[model samples]
Target: MAMEEKTPVTLGHRSRTLTAEEIEKLSDDKETVSDFKQRKLEEEAKKHWDKFYMRNETRFFKDRHWTTREFEELLGQDFELPSKATGDQPTLLEVGCGVGNMIVPLIEEGSAFRFLACDFSPRAVALLKENPMFSKGSHRAFVCDMTTSQLLEEVPRESVDIVTMIFMLSAISPEKMPTVINNVFSVLRPGGMVLFRDYGLYDQAQLRFKRGHKLRENFYARQDGTRAFYFSEEVVKSLFESAGFQTKENSYVTRSTINRKEGIDVPRIFVQSKFVKPQARYLMQFADGV
Candidate 1:
């Protein structure tokens, strides 16, 4: 049987200018940035992604399929849309939104939502800006390192109604995970929602890591050397709750795929979650300093 052709998706938006601090930090990280050995590995991975888009640039998934089909069903609920019902459009932020995979499709669906997308890679952001599907009026894209930068500085606080983190959070190191989560929380309005999906424990991709590829703990190196961390259900809850979100839905999804070459079947696990911030407020107590 012939292999099914993989269709590439077009998801593009405009790129934002990096701040001076971001430029300086990127420049000073010479070991990671300029080291010939590491640079070669990084370049190889980047080249792979570039080639992936070059070949499959026009295809896009029509909806937030993973979240809609998995988490929404498990929780027996639906997204609580804004109540104002105004002519003004709702705003959405897609962190680690690669090439507009989710954002572009949402826009094309004719929903009255504006989107802002961010990825740490300059190459990804550049391709997003160049794509004809990127509409400046309704969408914006930027190269942002969420772990170190201030999200509110670029995007106004309490301005976004929905934030999507599809298959993106597992890519960051565990230490930096809090920073990314907090940044997302700071920008979301009270009663806003966050939709998340990422790899779960023992997925084929996790088990495939070789010995030396272990970066730290559960984190593993991909073929292109980009790092990924798998999350347990408890860990996912802690990460979001610690950032002041209330987990409305959390569950593990198991799916099987045929391994034709091995003449067998394989199973994959994905953790899907929907978390919301409560409408109630907590009082802050300040201590006096001498």
Candidate 2:
């Protein structure tokens, strides 16, 4: 079957889904990394990410200024405590906060929520703490391996009001995803929420992998030694729902990434979703379609 090609329209424009033939072709490579190598990749995931931040510093990823534009729930009143309230400021924890790409922007945007950010890479955490904004607000940056460590040690259980997993969870091995999800769930308040975005199945990055890059089904070890697992909407829904989160929103988010200098334009697929940790007796519903 001939793969139907899509022409780029405009940056950030919605993109069409890949046909089955395209998906099959992209994943057809039979060769995969050896089990011994796969184990090494898993064991050194942190070291690779640390080296990544060490080399790239704060320059690799752009500031995620578009976060509020895409997930407006960040600015919702739920996270903004009443001016007169005596309680501690509402807390938002960012898991896998690399160099504060998401943290710095939200702070700059005049957000009122307190921030608690953690990353597996110690170097990334150090860089984030060095950012001028880190000391200016109610923000804390720390090093944590959520897959193997308990977030409760760093913060009180159910103390967080929101957790953002932007472009971060894909780096972990699939077997540990549940552990990470449960860690996030443990720290969230009863009515808290998780705002998630990560690479999706058939994303251009996924299709670009060649033979031997496949660590396992839908998972790959990049040349940098950092791993990524492309997600499906069903996988997103199932992982969170099974961890006791109620799904509020879960779907594929598509856009075209273009490079005019190289005359290259390609569709990028990402899964963006919202899942809520329900209150014992009630589940909060937003009128704005959170």
Candidate 3:
């Protein structure tokens, strides 16, 4: 059998840039320059996100309809998402599972594998729990700040088989990303995998930002207070590699969306990757003995 090292998705779409006026408006910098200097918006990241969830209330990002499609392991009979299949049955922990947008679809499909969905925002967690599909039977949703908070406190140590980080890590400050990865690493069982998806460098969203909204280089804090960071492939690869993960898949995905009424075409670029934690030395030995 061949390993699905890369996602089997088309990778090219022409890039698009927002209009100049749109850039100016987005970069207006709602905070006073003096406040921006003194308060450090990145430090108050949690507050910004909390307020973002409060304002939009689980309605901003659409449910990800592409998850199970991109990752075959999600549906393959061999992996079989969570029933009493055996120790190898895949258990999942969605790192920043906001409002269960991604997990709900899988749960609705009826899986045997257990899932733990967590978000930093209490409101996001609350909203996830509110979903009609949410139940403690196969899914467990909770509030957890992966950057500073200990994942083990809410989850068992090294128990997760798959940790999904979809469109979520970009919200963390680049400086703290290592800490977040290390934290997630601590909770993953040996040989577990982390599936990642996020904005790529020079993506349309990054190109749309103007000066005042810029936080450092590719990082930006939006007028709504929530922030985002565009990633370079090297950076993403390095971050996971530094934390003892073996890179399996690391590539960019590009898709063009057309707006017929507005007569505009938008190109979106995203990075998709998969990294695996090494199995314990003794576990390898035990398997070899068999």
Choose the strongest candidate by TM-score: 2
After superposing candidate 1, which stretches have Cα over 4 Å from the reference?
1-67, 71-77, 83-87, 286-290
Summed backbone clashes in each candidate are 4, 0, 5
lDDT of each: 0.69, 0.85, 0.77
Candidate 3 at 72: error in angstroms? 1.3
Q: What TM-score, to 2 decimals, does candidate 3 have? A: 0.80
Which candidate, 2 or 3, would have the higher TM-score against the true structure? 2
- What is the per-residue lDDT of model 2 for residues 144-218, given as tens digits with 9 covering 90 to 100? 999875677998888888899998889988889999999998888887889999998778898888777998888
Judged by whole-model lDDT over C-alpha atoms, candidate 1 comes out at 0.69
**Highest lDDT, which number?**
2
Candidates 2 and 3 compared: the better one by lDDT is 2
Task: Give the alpha carbon lDDT tens digit for every residue of 80-116 in model 3.
Answer: 2322334565678999998888888887788555889
lDDT of 2 at 232: 87
